[model samples]
Target: HASFFHGGPNGSMGFKAIVNLLGIENYFGKTEYNNDADFDGTWGIWDEPFFKFFANKLSSFREPFFSAIFSVSSHHPFKIPEKYTGKFKKGPLPVLECIGYTDYALRQFFEKTKKTSWFKNTLFVITADHATVCYHPEYLNPWGEVAIPILFYAPGDSSIAGVKQAVVSQIDIMPSILSYLHYSKPYFAFGESVFDKNRKNFSVTFTGNYRWIENDYLLLFDGKKSSGLYQYKTDRLFNNNLVSKNPGQVASMEKTLKAYIQQYNNRLIQNRLTPFSDLNYKKSQTKNP
Candidate 1:
């Protein structure tokens, strides 16, 4: 895993903390950190060099592996490299240009990796940590502000190529990956499998208050009660509060959201995330067993 920040094998927060808690810190062959003085500084390192470093580490590994690379060039203070200044299209926000540069760098990385032995077997999941500056009014609402792309690409197979119209959240990625690997085990997750056609897609977020989206309806809760409801499909701006107009829908979605919040909160407080009492549980257990 190539992390642009949070240096060392075990950082206080982020991915390292989770890995350490799960006792899988030693499982990873290489864990690259950009905060090392050798990289100059976190802001100084660009996408190209970082990706090149990642490619080198990936090529060195002999067995199947899982890796994650987080790019920092497109982050705040969004400075474009002097040599590639005019290479990208400029937009309202400076981050747009930075995004273009990152996109180009990603393409180059993929082009280089395609020739490697590990390229064909890789499953690439691309997503943003958060949404950036909004340019259009349509994307200025709560839903639009939180909207970010989640894409799944399998180089070895084209069977899952088509776009899924159903909404999926970041939490769903882990279950989806496990499902794709045909992992046979009982696990607890707040997210449902994205590949399950019968499952309803939903997402939950908290800014100043809790916001839950299910189907076309969005419900806003103020910890104590649901304050607002909107049908995002019809009212993109969320200008009209449909709490009174759609009582049944509001009640149903509110109940579901409250239940989700209760489950999530209780799980977090109880430290019940792991399926096994010990971290060394075998993955060989059959589905029915």
Candidate 2:
């Protein structure tokens, strides 16, 4: 069974659509906006107490269940609860204090769950859907602009505790989780398993044009031809362009990126994202070029 917990009014709209499409149970905190004292008067409920409320509801689920919870108190306007007004220090950005409040809320939720029966066996994966405003120069480029944290936590397992020095995208999370669980089923996914160290994984982002990253280099491709190439590992600012110098690398990366674009658009338009639907098909039969 799968369940989703949404912490705000409008936030639930998108999540509810996904949960309904997947035919799963969902808890929208907006329903409690009228009576709950935790409401921030702007957003729905404050994450501090709402997380505790989420914990109570999560306890009702049976074993072998999948759950997703979203926190909204860290959003815009960035207001904490009345009692926690001066609790968190305000940094250069207004969102910092709000993040601190949500951190406290997550701590409370974890404390409550630690004593629960399923705590030991649960694998918690934390991530953000996208990156937001940047205050630092390091995140000014295309790769850094879309980069968000993806963390895996298993409280009872010491083997899962290590810093991974690999580039991975959010699309890789499902395959990584399945790999960790030793799942042996054949599946179709655009991303590779992060647990497989030998596998070469890359990520693509489109901000007007396509930016693809593999190993240490970042290649920028406009719809027609290759525009720029940079070794992002050494040149964090992306000031130098290697397209004129490295013709072979440009040709290789552009070909790969075009194949990715073709596969993504064709699969999405034709509704053949699954392996079952893609069987007995050839690349020549694809609609998108």
Candidate 3:
């Protein structure tokens, strides 16, 4: 099941295009969407309906299944259900209150699912699409804007549980899951499997400018040059730019960032994202010439 409570699969052109390209448009046994028009012109239905859809759909699947659920009550216009109006204390930002409501809904969903037969055998991965408004000054920096929680929960296996000190991102989810399932096939992905001990964990994000995070350092790059470098562990606010002071680190991270940009650009240009038989292309020649 690929269930969405907010935007349907066809809502975004980019999303539709990617799904079509990957040939995963019909991959799910069920694709559920919230039709707001049925609710007398209301948009953004509550999260409960989504949970119910997941429960009902999963019950019908006889074979192994992969599913995704997207929750949107935490998003704007930031409406807290009438039943939860005064439940949570008002925070600095309106979104925080909405977050409380959404969290409660998630807790309820889990409580109901834990009694199910599949709950003990499932691997539940929780993550947010993006972060909300930064209320604290410390989290107002470029790195902080992209900061969101990523958690993995395998009910029967306790070995993979607990905190992972390594940095990871949303892109790593697919590869990590494939690795966990012991998938033996060639595939193209921008991210390495986080569970692969031999692979270094890092995250790359771009919103107008580019930011690359590896270990303790974060390097920010504009189109032409490295503008800021900070030890995020020590400098949470990013007030200090160590680009001039740490030339070696800047150069190393810049080289990595450039390689990532080149690979991404090359892939998009060549339309080699999908692992189809006909579109045989060599590895990206993004290495320094």
lDDT of each: 0.74, 0.81, 0.73
Model 1: per-residue Cα lDDT over 108-147, one tens digit each:
8898899998898988888988888877887888889789
Flag regions of model 1 displaced more than 4 Å: 1-15, 24-44, 277-289
The window of 10 residues in a row where model 1 has the poorest summed lDDT is: 1-10
Instruction: Say which candidate scores most in TM-score.
Output: 2
Write the number of the candidate with greater lDDT, choosing between 1 and 2. Answer: 2
Best by lDDT: 2
For candidate 3, the TM-score is 0.86
lDDT of 2: 0.81
Ranking by TM-score: 2, 3, 1
Our model 2 lands, by Cα RMSD against the true structure, at 3.3
* Model 3 backbone overlap count: 0
Clashes of each: 0, 0, 0
Residues 1-289, candidate 2: write the lDDT tens digits: 6877776774445777777876876545567434466677777788877788777777877878888877788878888988988989888899989988988998999999999998889889988878867787777987788888889999989888888877788889889888988989777888888879786868888889998888877888988988899888788887889989999998988888899999999988876787766763545356545
Candidate 1 versus truth, CA RMSD in Å, comes to: 5.1
How many pairs in model 2 have backbone atoms within 3 A of each other, for residues 3 or more apart or on separate chains, i.e. clashes?
0
List the lowest-lDDT window of 10 residues for candidate 2: 280-289
Reference-based TM-score of each model: 0.86, 0.89, 0.86
Better of 1 and 3 by TM-score: 3
